[model samples]
Target: MAKELEAGFTGSPVEKPEGMRKVASDTASAIKREANAVAIGVSDHPQAAGSLVLGIGAAAFGLGYLLGRSSVSTRTRYWR
Candidate 1:
């Protein structure tokens, strides 16, 4: 047990890096493919995409405004 502990890892360091490189490349390619698909879909339906984006932006702005109004301190000061 002590000898094994002292020896630590027996595998080559290069193996770990090669596996990580393959994983990174696969993830990058998947993201690129999904992005291209979304771009093509948006281009095919520009009006729908624009409407959806506008609706989402408007909803976000309204939510922020309501939150800001609700958080204001409106207590009346006795001496001010």
Candidate 2:
């Protein structure tokens, strides 16, 4: 046990161990901010769901219009 203690004491001195505290605090604060963001997302779940549905509907309508136009063009060109 004495030899182990001596060995442990033989390590180099830290230049600034206090700097580690700042890093720990920064990490903790970032984690807290992310947690708050998740909470806000949960709170807005209903609105998000509605927006997703609206987005999908708009995309489908746009795709359908494009495809219909292409098909019409092909038919007309073939008839000519």
In order, how many clashes per candidate?
0, 0
- lDDT of predicted model 1: 0.89
lDDT of 1 at 59: 100
Give residue 73's error in model 2 in angstroms: 2.7
The number of residue pairs in model 1 that clash at the backbone is 0
lDDT of 2 by residue, 1-80 (tens): 34534445677567644687779978999999999997788677978867888999999999999999887744434454
Give Cα distance to truth, residue 45, candidate 1, Å.
0.3
Which lDDT tens digits does candidate 1 get at residues 1-80?
Answer: 35535557776676444587889978999999999999999999999999999999999999999999999979967976
Give stretches of model 1 more than 4 Å off.
1-19, 78-80
Q: In TM-score terms, which candidate is top?
A: 1
TM-score of each: 0.65, 0.37
Worst lDDT run of 10 residues, candidate 1, spans 1-10
